[model samples]
Target chain A: MKDWEKNIRIVEPYVPGEQPNFPEMIKLNTNENPYPPSPRVQKAKEELSIDILRLYPDPTSNLLVEELANYYGRKKEQVFVGVGSDDVLSVAFLTFLNSKKPILFPDITYSFYSVWADLYRIPYERPAVDENFQINKEDYYKENGGIIFANPNAPTSISVDLEFIEDILEHNQDVIVIVDEAYIDFGGISANSLIDRYENLLVVQTFSKSRSMAGMRIGFAMGNERLIKAMNDVKYSINSYTMNQPSLYLGVEAIKDEDYFRENINKIIFTRENTKNSLEKLGFDVLDSKTNFLFISHSQYKAEDIFAELRENKIFVRHFNLPRISNYLRVTVGTDAEMECFIRSIEEFLLKRA
Target chain B: MKDWEKNIRIVEPYVPGEQPNFPEMIKLNTNENPYPPSPRVQKAKEELSIDILRLYPDPTSNLLVEELANYYGRKKEQVFVGVGSDDVLSVAFLTFLNSKKPILFPDITYSFYSVWADLYRIPYERPAVDENFQINKEDYYKENGGIIFANPNAPTSISVDLEFIEDILEHNQDVIVIVDEAYIDFGGISANSLIDRYENLLVVQTFSKSRSMAGMRIGFAMGNERLIKAMNDVKYSINSYTMNQPSLYLGVEAIKDEDYFRENINKIIFTRENTKNSLEKLGFDVLDSKTNFLFISHSQYKAEDIFAELRENKIFVRHFNLPRISNYLRVTVGTDAEMECFIRSIEEFLLKRA
Candidate 1:
């Protein structure tokens, strides 16, 4: 490598989830929605011609922000939008965490949080989640710098109760607390309700999971106007023009079609329950999931072997290369048909190994 | 307000140009293209519907990056795309300015540079451009942590020579030097020629100007693989998925359709040349412009009053409130027919005041 800038040389890059290029594989990775976005999304894009591409998108993303505000029942000032939940969290790290104090987060949560901390040179502490992988409310009551964690934490899919989250907010009034609800809408409650009560709390959510618009790269933050104003300041200083025009329209349409979203939620919930039950019947232990995916490991079969066997049979699932979660396979709940195919293939792979 | 993190407590917000609500105003406040983007942009959007919106965008923006590489004859690994050039520049600041030394930029260049410095708490020095507001080649050759400036410099539209820029890069061995070519495709000499010679040289361009895909929110950097990799590391740590799918299609199409781009660019260039000549005829001092806009002022008329008169007559051009530029107005060149109307309106405004 070249003798790069000291900061660039120092940064440790974050690896995103596997986007396998095996065209014929039955992909169950990346936690994308199996169902398509609202029909209105396609209709909106079809209706919006490429010619509008000549003009710059609204620097503020004002329209989508207002629509999101109405969706969450908050004032327009309380809402902010960005490229994705990852982007929102990254900016939040910059806006709230720096030299003045060390930031705090769960040790077993999303891996990108620590990456952002390192990239910005922000000091942060990982208060370990309990043995059951739950963020301890008591651990966060004392002052640090800022706080953030993924709800229904990744790999484990276990959610912390909202009351416990609120208690932490009430106790830690001096710091900025962020709740990342990337997978919340699958079957969990949103902390959006707590926005009006807490001025220092910034709850970030993504359209990628629930709205089935991950391809559009839209995520938002809801909080007291002061915190939002700070994020907006950071956003403007970076890219006044953040969201693309098509995503802007698609995001607005995705939130407006409540019936489509509610239907998709029910479908995923049903599939997740059925899939968990089926895996258990096959001697696998599955985490109690409130997300679109299952955190599972078979007592008789190795997680890596099952992961490999499925891949050999053209059925793709996720396996992290990390230490804590390496024993579990995170399988995204796909359509009923895709899930059926996955189960049958897994049964065959396990039977062959036996 | 609340006891928040101290880093952002003193952060101030940026004010964009006036997006006034007057229904009948001939809007020219921001330097947006007078004409719409190619019909192909709409065609691409219409072709992809709501179904595609459900999926997540390719996290790396692979297709667009490859297309840019092929077009520029550079390695795909050497380019990094972002939501906008503003986003690209911000990432650059985060990646490069953390060097042991502080960044050096023109005092009167893009206003947002200082805002980013303040936001990130980056130490910087504002080296003044020469009396004519031209970037002094010798001034930039001195020691610097990093260096960046908009070529054909904004508001002044005074293009810098290629050799002087080369001289600066020749001297700064350990530092990253950036050329923000926001208005480059209009007519300024590209610093891209020096990119192959210097590993530290980065030339950032936007679809907002040359490609006319401003609304789509795409900008990128052209540098060697190491620098691009560093920028991508910052992007991934901040926001893994910066571009959405539909905007990806728009960018691909915009770059491929060089005929459409050439036709529009030529027209804007012609309009700029004509406008500059006409203003000179009216006894106004006009900066030598190599962009789609003109910067002009008269010795007699007050710049603010002239700006006010134009607004009253429904012809809006940008007039900065800053000290050095308060005397001049920056006007974006429009279509031939639109420019004809604008000149007539301005002629009337100037004569009536005379």
Candidate 2:
């Protein structure tokens, strides 16, 4: 290596799910919503003047922030928007997780938490989840720099109640507590209600899942004015114009259509329930999921084998090679027809193995 | 202060120019292109399918990156794309400016450089520009963590030739050197040609100026493969999907129309020359500008007074309150009709002052 290379900050990057583009593949690996964005989004795009491409977008993203604040019943100053939930969470980690003490999170929660910790050189500790993939509230009660975890945890598809979250937050008042609600709109309760009560609490959500606008890359966080201001300070220091003009315009439209948002979310939940029942009948132990995905494992077969078979048949799902979760597959609840195909494919593979 | 607020990382953010929205205002503060994006961009927007908004954009931004590589005559492995050049530069600072030594730049260059260093906690040194608003190549010959300066530097609107840049590169062989060429398309030459020879060099540019797409927020960097890979690793660690789908699609169309690109650039240059002559004839000292903007100071008046008077007439121009440049105003060259109005307004202000 060159001498200058010694100074380069090297990091083990977070590996996102493969975005394979086969013509007929069922893409359920990333937990993206199966439904299109609201038709108002289409109309917004149509109305967006091509002439305005010459100017910069509002650095503060007031239009989208006001809409989100109105919808979520928070003051505009209490809300912050970014390129995505990942961007919002990354900024939060940098702004809040800065003490000499190590931050804490569930060992099996969103993997990007640890990656962000490592990238910023913030010391962190991962408290192990119990055998049921549940985050123990007591585990985070100790002294730490900060705390963050997914509410409905990724790759496990299990959610803890608001009372459980409040239990942890009540213990940790001297530090910031971040509850990632990326999957909350599916079925889980959000911690947004507790933000006014707990000045240190920050609740984050995304447009990628329930709103079905992942391609536009919109996400937001709701907290007290002070926390939101500090995050905005860090975001502005990094990149002022993050949310492009089209996203600012179309995101408002996405949030305005409440009926369409409810309809698609219900569709996904309905599919999740039917898929869970079908998998249980085929001898797969499926975790109780409040999110739009199911975590399942077969008693008689290895998940790696099932994952390979599914890929060969153009059915995509997520399988982590991590400890305690290597045997499980996280399948995003797709359209009913897509889930039906996934169930049928898994059944055939199991019968052949038997 | 609350105990939780004690550990929060605080920063003084880079304040961007005002994006005022007035129907009759001549918006010349932000240096955005005074023309629309290529006609092909509109066609591409029309062709985009709203159905695809359900999926996340390609994390690598391969479509845009490949197109940039093809346009710049670099290998696909040697280019990286981000939300904007500010995003590209921030990641570069975090990736390559990690040495214990302080990095170097002109004291009055892009203000965001210092902000990024502060946000990342990297030590830096700013050598003052000479009386001519020129970077002294000898000032950068000493040891440093990194070096970055805008060619045709902002506010000053002066550029250093390739030989001067090559001289700095020769002395700073042990550190990374970044050339920010955000305005190079107007008249100045790019340092992209030296990337193959200087493996430690990173060149950043933006479409927000010449391509008339500030609203889309597209920017890219060209460097050696190892440097590009390291930046990508850091970017992935921050946000895997920085580019939205519409930007990825429309940026490709923006770059494909070389004829339109050249024509608009020539138009801006023509208007800039005319504006410079007009300002100089009015007893204002205008710097030799290779950019779409002019740095001018009146011999008989304060730039602040001129800026305020112009605002009264709904004409916006940028005036920084920083040292050495306080008397100067950075006026973006708008369309011919707008410049005529600006000149006429300035003439009236001067006549009244006399």
> Model 1, range B1-354, lDDT digits (tens) per residue?
446645564567887777665666666666777777776765665566566667777888898999999988788998889988889999988888877667888888888889888877777888887778887777777766788889979878888889878888887867888999988988889888788889899999988876777788889999988899888877777878788888787788778877888888898998889988888888788999888788889888888888888887778889998978898998888777767777887799777876
Candidate 2 per-residue C-alpha lDDT over B1-354 given as tens digits, one digit per residue, 9 for 90 to 100: 999898999898667678888889998899999999999999998888989888999998989999999999999999999989999999999999999899999999888999999999999999999998988899999989999999989978999889998999999888999999999998898899999899999999999999999999999999999999999999999999989999999999999999999999999999999999999999999999999999999988999999999999999999999999999999999999999999999999999999
By DockQ, the best candidate is: 2
Off by over 4 Å in 2: none
Per residue, candidate 2 scores C-alpha lDDT tens digits across A44-104 of 8888887888899999999999999999999999999999999999999999999999999
**Which regions in candidate 1 have their CA more than 4 angstroms from the true location?**
A1-9, B5-9, B21-24
TM-score of 2: 0.99
Tens-digit lDDT string for candidate 1 (A1-354): 454455454577876667777776777888889988888876776677566677777878888999998988999999989988888888788787764577888888788888988887788888887766777878887768888878878868888778888888888888888899999998777888887778778899999888898888898989988888888887887778888787788789888999999999999999999999999988898888999899998878888988998888788899886766777899999999889988998899778888
